[model samples]
Target chain A: DVKVTQSSRYLVKRTGEKVFLECVQDMDHENMFWYRQDPGLGLRLIYFSYDVKMKEKGDIPEGYSVSREKKERFSLILESASTNQTSMYLCASRLAGVGELFFGEGSRLTVL
Target chain B: EDQVTQSPEALRLQEGESSSLNCSYTVSGLRGLFWYRQDPGKGPEFLFTLYSAGEEKEKERLKATLTKKESFLHITAPKPEDSATYLCAVQAGGDTGRRALTFGSGTRLQVQP
Candidate 1:
């Protein structure tokens, strides 16, 4: 079975503080993604990485950045957290050419 | 733009009741349609993947069918444990590099005794 693990399941940060969410996958998948899920807006993509040290901005990448220095790890960075940034963050990974993704348990971030 | 929408933001059913959830989509070219079940506070769990119209997949009491413009997830004799948020996503054509998926708001179902 494929497994994806997030560094934290819940986090709280003060406004303007830097925050980092880490994700790791054991399946050696080539594709990884970050998304923030909201009540009515659904899951909106924040960033994705296709290979080591490579990344792309998704639909809502503002105030967020990502790092993929290693194939098995992906990190989402909030340069300066704000209250509006609070949401359920999810990480997913899939093999090359495969359409199905395996996701981590998710990290719920609270920016106060 | 590519998009996916799910109907019946919430549904309540009695145990042993049968019903279907709808997922409507619009994309330039469709590669696959996916169904996922998500428990509260957890990520989605994959259920089925339909590649073309008339294609169907099943696991236990859940069945998923696909058409040109939409997909349906039918639950038969559902139990209380079946209650969860059902999500639908579409894989679009073009060099997305298998990057991202467009997801629906999801249909939350509750099954009672």
Candidate 2:
């Protein structure tokens, strides 16, 4: 089974703080994605990386950025956290050309 | 633009009850449709994938069926342990080479003992 690990399960930060969420996949998948799941909105893509140092904007990428310096790791950075950014964040990985995704346990962020 | 919608935002069933969840989609072209089970505070767990119409897949008490524009996940004799949110997503095909999926809001199921 593929293992996708998130650096944190729960986090709380004050408003205007910078936050970093890290994710690592052990299967060497070429595609990694970050999504925020909220009630009544499902999961909305924030960012996705297909290769090292390559990234693309998803539907809702306004306040977020991503780093993919290595093949097996993808990180999401919130430059300035706000109350609206409080939600459950998920990281998923998949092989190129495959639609199936292996997801991490998820990181829940609370900005107060 | 690709879109996915799931019916019955929430469902309540008895331990021995059987029911089905619906997923409707509209995409320029369809590559695959996927079903996932998500527990509270956890990421989704992949369940089944339907590549084309008339495709079906089963695992334990859950069976998934797909058509041209919709998919169904049938849970037979669900148990209390089966309570979770079921999510559906679609990947577009054709010139859109992107592999990212568009997901529905999901159907939350709770089976009472």
Among all windows of 10 consecutive residues in model 2 chain A, the one with the lowest summed lDDT is A94-103
- For B27-58, candidate 2 gives per-residue lDDT tens digits of 97788999999999889999999999999999
Candidate 2 positional error at A22, Å: 0.2
Worst 10 residues of 2 chain B by lDDT: B93-102
- After superposing candidate 2, which stretches have Cα over 4 Å from the reference? B95-97
Model 1 lDDT, residue A1, Cα: 98
Candidate with maximal lDDT: 2
Clashes of each: 0, 0
- In the order shown, what is each candidate's alpha-carbon RMSD? 0.9, 1.0
All candidates: TM-score: 0.98, 0.98
TM-score of model 1 relative to the true fold?
Answer: 0.98
Docking class of 2: medium
Q: For model 1, report DockQ.
A: 0.76
DockQ of each model vs. true complex: 0.76, 0.75
